[model samples]
Target: MTESTEPVKINKWDGAAAKNAIDDAIREVLTGDLKCKESFALIDGRLFLCALAVGVALYALLWDYLYPFPQSRLVLIICVSSYFVLMGILTLYTTFKEKGIFVVAKEKVGNVTRVWEASSYVKKHDDKYNLVLVLREPSGKTREASINKTFANYIDSNGTIVQNLVASEVTKLYNSLSSEKKEK
Candidate 1:
């Protein structure tokens, strides 16, 4: 479906719906690229091949000199160790990469033309939602807060709802600050 240029109205959205909408948007940003599963499969395939070659060479060298284990078990040992190492490395790499992508997506979705004093994103932990709000002051400093909020059943596929919600929240914050300044 085509994305709407118009801002989504926040008044109609319940808290759960808004949180779901944000989560959907973040998921899209996380996996929208690469198009198909083949890309990932291909990556793992190449890594496996490389790991196998390294494992074989290392095992041969050790068997010839150190003889770390029984010669008969070289193949089995190398294969199992290589597999574990490959999995461990991939796990770490994927975790860090995905996290970086998540942070970038959150920053992109939360900041509205730099008008808002800060930006925010929702992170799901177990059954709860944690709103990670980053506050940027006029002094060019920043602070982050993770506020846990409860949300129930709701769904919104498009990102517009979450975007609008953030904008609305920022606007309200700005208005409140302005009023406070005036009163002072």
Candidate 2:
């Protein structure tokens, strides 16, 4: 229930208990620190909204400067507002259109089941122990995306997301899975 502010003792993370760490933090922890120290503690969509608001306000200031005449001031204000509004809309669309989320798979789903870096829509299933991640491109396009699996450990509906797993973690998982396959 408490977060470890005790400081990260390791510079590198081995994939030993990452799943358990991620799962426990997501369920009970309210805040977390990511690799770059970026806090995803809250998934606030206000970022875009704030940028848009600032842009609009700046455009208003510009409009006032451009129009010394009160009669023309109204027209310029409307035009500048409209232009900034369009630009802001485009900016938000482009940012949200990029792949900002990824899914990691645990097992093979179909013939092509593999966990590569891809965007997705994740939901906590009725069995909170398991999560369902529906992969989709950030373009919000109708085209299909590759499906992958991840156990409950990596996601913290409550914590901020760190850079996906580190390189060492991926290597560890791959090696473990490969060995397990050889055994089977």
lDDT top scorer: 1
Q: Over the stretch 12-68, how does candidate 1's per-residue lDDT look in tens digits?
A: 235555655555443333223311111243246546756776776676666656544
Question: All models: lDDT?
Answer: 0.43, 0.39
Instruction: Please give, for residues 1-184, the per-residue lDDT of candidate 2 as tens digits.
Output: 2344331222113232443344333322212221112233123344555566667677677667776668567756676777677677656654674333323222343443333222333343421223222222233422222323453234334333332432223344344443543475
Q: Which stretches of candidate 1 lie over 4 Å from their true place?
A: 5-21, 26-76, 93-127, 133-143, 152-163, 166-184
Total backbone clashes of candidate 1, pairs 3 or more residues apart or in separate chains: 0
Model 1, position 184, has a per-residue lDDT of 57
Model number with the top TM-score: 1
Give per-candidate clash totals.
0, 6
Name the Cα RMSD for model 1.
11.2
